[model samples]
Target: MQDLEIIASAGASFRPGDIPPPPDGGIEAWTQVAMGWIVIFATWGYVNSFGSFQAHYTSTLPQSPFQISWIGSIQVWFTFFGSAFSGRLLDAGFWIPTFLVGAGLQLIGIFMMSLSTSYWHLMITQGVVTGIGGGIIFAPSLALVATYFEKRRGIAIGLVTTGNSLGGTVYPLVVRALLPSIGMPWTARVLGFINLAGFILVAIFMRPRLPPRQTGPIIDWSAFRDTLYVSYVGGLFFFVWSVYYTFYYLASFGQQEVGMSFADSSLITTIINAVGLPTRVLIPVLADRIGPLNTIAPAALCVAIVAYTWVAVHDVAGVYIFSIFYGIASGAFQSLMPTGVASITTRLDTIGSKSHWGSYLGCAVEYTLRGAIGARESFEGWLEGKD
Candidate 1:
């Protein structure tokens, strides 16, 4: 009892050398993975379901599809951009406090979104506030889980990432089933309750394993010096730049281009997310053997090929087939991304910091560029129709 008390009290003061190595497997370590699953499910999983919101908002709100997409884009931008700060906090042994603040902001954003009546209101609450909240907690939780396993880190991250698929699948269903019956405010409230419950569990159970890495700059300027790291991050930037295009716009495409009803279009988002479930888990197991880098390179190539095929999809049957293929390809890449980052990071303690830098560069920097591309694509399609 006294020993447990001492460890708990030592938060933020103990040096990295005093801490033990990752146990790699145990009830406690696996429990962190479980908690991480909840975190990912609530954060990225919810983000993945934005297509549902996009389609709904396009109809009910006075915003153009391009304008409505900014809500989701800014949400993603905040989540990715804020990771650098929050992740450093994790390394500094501020995990509990950081998580509490983040979770609180997230819940507030969601509940407030229920009352928002206009585009700017939704942008503030759903896009900025909620994105900030999720950003604070997301990378830290995954970094924490990464610290629990070395050999199995790939599979561990893989399992936790399955939350992305399930959350994406479930949230849309919730919106589809309840939006017409209960209305948008109630639907948003329900999502809030679900996130609130999961966060409570995460707070109670997820404990950080490493003592604070007491001395290091948060930015880790040294990582930029590594040749392999820079190259990998450069590739990741392009992938993140374009990868979300389908997840965010596929449903809108179904309605406008494929001539599907809103309900069926929403299902397109769900199918894309759901089909990812198996690949996200299984591909990491393969990555564990061959190396995360090797596994991810091929997976990324597959995702690109599948995305290019999107231009050819013109009918309802083609849409379904495209969604399934893209979901599997993207899921495999998504599950491996963080694991790949962890593999390259030499020091276990810097995992959070490095992962944050990678994500910030990949997701945040890519967002604005991707948004411009989306706008240009929409305009070109409009002009083609005129011809």
Candidate 2:
């Protein structure tokens, strides 16, 4: 928090030309980029698959939609909330401890989730345990990935961000495949093993290149006065709220309202993630040359357009069309966010505060939006009105 405030305060006074150059590319740097990518793949990949669980639970459990959503909401919210402290820890050079502990807890959480038979059980295991761990890992994956590249940072971070898209894209299919024969418990176990493998590699390769910034007052509160930071944070708050709410609930919406089979409904998630994969990578490359914010605004606008189109859809064809357009637009928004934040911040020490932690603060509001949407009675009536 103070880390970002101080940086935002400093960056507010500096000209863009004064920003220092990064190594841009080196063997070690790209290697670290790979490490960041893998951690994101495991951490976010797990969270991104929650739409599958959300849809499945709506049918199997007696829990209301609002109640079932708490598990996923908690899981995702912690990923944002925990990162504020984890970002500080990374700045303090505690990467190894943070990474390993997060991996262990995440694995345990995934395994524990497999045993869940009730709402509270899932809320504790998947929501609390795994969510906290995911947040811890998520901080560095965004923060550290930036330390290695500057000129092409948009694409580099974009590549790592694709972990969100790729994991979302692939894990749904993996869970769908495993659920029939192996069931949820064994299926979760398989994912746990994969998490162990991916994170082990991250543990070995992920290192903090910069020494800890221990001398400061921690976070400077005054950075909130910076207009750019304020605008950036405010914009993302509403943007992510809508994106997350839509993606998380989309499968169940397809199933119950659109008459998609469980398999077909689940496939909506797969398609959204799949369409985002290439867009995540390629769009950031565009952001690099054209500018991240310029790249982000148009894409963000398109997301708004497609989201409105979601209501008009009465069949799979309309859903697919919405998925394709929304996926590309939202993918650009996700991939460009770090780049956009970093572009304005002149200091490395505060970059995490400005980007990861700042966005986390913005994300808290999303839970409110999600909770509103989670209440199926009201949300369904709204959806019915759309028809």
Candidate 3:
């Protein structure tokens, strides 16, 4: 329940040379860190729970998969796109306003979704509004993790990012259970209330380690001129593309190609997410010891290979194996990305003046869109017997 003002006040006391060493055995420090993780989990949970909503919307609306998909797509797009903007704001020490605006947008979007009666309504409410909201909420979580921990940065990031996996697991089951009883509108309304509560908790507890004035952009445009940064960005593009595609399509693929029942397919998706929860925590720890990119490259390659191989598998066992392996690999890739970015941007503090977090995040989102397009194309091809 600590406020940003309190965090800032504490941070302000430290001079450049007096910056306190990372705290040890301090329950307060741990609590602050935990609160940041909670915020991340809440935000990411909403983000990853899209599959649950996607399934329900597809079933209930039937005429609007395209539109419903937009809800998630836009959420993700804004999540990444908004990061660019929010990152800069966070760097500029507007943590309180950032959190408030994000929480408000998310709450409004959820309420709006509850009233939606058509595809366009969902698109505007869920896609644009909610997407924007989620994006704002997500930015501070990532930025704060970096500010808090240096030695265990990878593990910390991974732990926080695992919230997406946990959300993916829990939200779907909630939707699946509620859909047959309360129906979509009520389910959405209930979800809105839940999001409101979660965001309130975030506003109460999440705080930045650095003072507002000392906090500035960690992102640098000139870094992109470095071949290593370009490679990292390009690699991340493909990595995110593959990650989203697998998440979006794995269930459908199981049902269609592996002959799994709908219940079974849903279970498979849940299992994949569940398995990812641990990987989200573990892989980053490993990356911390070895190297993030070194770890990420292999993990990504494995995902691409295993994902394609899933196309050839049959029955529950094959799909299950694919789901577990692919999930772990994909989860590792997700955990390592930010670390990879951080590793390349080591001079971030010095280069803060020229930082354009928005532009960098915009590039990442562009790649995400490209990935989504590729997934759609693959789905279309599969439907047409091309794959």
Candidate 4:
């Protein structure tokens, strides 16, 4: 009992030297990074392409923008919030089962989403079910990167995160073509198959190196008392809150305000993710060299400026320029948030715990503001910046 109390008390304050050495670079380690990349490609990629769906729903359905946004909102909420549950599972050494179930659920969710016709059906399957699976896959995919590449952790994480950018870039374009010709049901089914391919690789290659320490409480509330941890969490919450606003609404803004074709509007999203692909890789290399916080802090400031600047653009050229800057900046933010959390954590083993805390709370920040009551105001996006 006393030993347990001592561990609980020690919590996130433990020393870093206690951490086991990572493989740094070997065939197994690189394979894990590749697997993590595919994992995010299957999950976050879908989330990144939500704007394409949002535009279609707003134009086709009788549902109000407020109602439609909720679908995306719920999915986003669970994608991050569900991590609170799955991260603990990973920490307890249930890697194989947790990952398999997550991949399976994602397969089911996407297939179910294809059959959805009503608002509630889409919300339940695509928004809730898929998001939960995303959380399950996400926690372990991220944690393994930290485990395998102690010295190049940032670079490894950045590589995996680029999958989000790649999926975002590819999916919007793919769906845009399919939705116009093949239609929604087929479009979703095609995406499900893509996810299946990634899942196979994940089952084959993804792994964790160390056993769960189980060294302390599932959550170390005591870590909240640390000024650095607290400050980092606060900043991350606000930064995350500010992101995706651009991604979700940019397609609508292009078509509605600038009078672009649906194809052109969707292309705007493709541009952002395309620009992000290189940025995701390059910025994390910088993060490793200069430290994640120094890299993250400046990147956050750049994104905020880009977010508010959306109001001034009234032309395709201006929007294109905006996409270039926002993609690079936002990519840095997405890649760095988990990396940043991992940085201030006192012990390597506790990194997953710290990440879930920040991500769960950050989802709350976005969800509360994006709720139905203030829905239109929020989705107008950029706050006096769009719509």
Say which candidate scores most in lDDT.
1
RMSD of 3: 6.7
C-alpha lDDT values of all predictions? 0.86, 0.76, 0.64, 0.78
* Order of candidate numbers by lDDT, starting with the best: 1, 4, 2, 3
How well does candidate 1 match the true structure in TM-score terms?
Answer: 0.92
Each prediction's TM-score versus the true structure: 0.92, 0.91, 0.82, 0.91
For candidate 2, write residues 1-387 as lDDT tens digits.
335434543553333464344567888778788888888888877787788888888889997656677788788788878776677677667788888888888999999989988888989999999988988878766787787676778889999988888888778898889998989999889989988988888888777666676754445444467677667777876676656766777787777777788777788888888788898899989877776767778888988887887768777788778878887888878888877777666567666555555456656876776566555564556555431
For residue 149, give model 1's deviation from the true position in Å: 0.4
What clash pairs does model 3 have? none
Which lDDT tens digits does candidate 1 get at residues 1-387? 334223322321224565566888999999999999999999999999999999899789976777788888888889887777788889989999999999999899999999999999999999999999999999999999988887788899999999999999999999999999999999999999999999999999999998898799887889889776676677787788778778888888888777888899999889999999999999999987777877888999999999888778889999899999999999999999888778777676887887756556667766666555545546336324331
lDDT of 4 at 14: 35
Instruction: Please identify model 4 stretches exceeding 4 Å from their true place.
Output: 1-19, 372-382, 385-387
Using lDDT as the measure, name the better of candidate 1 and candidate 4.
1
lDDT of 4: 0.78
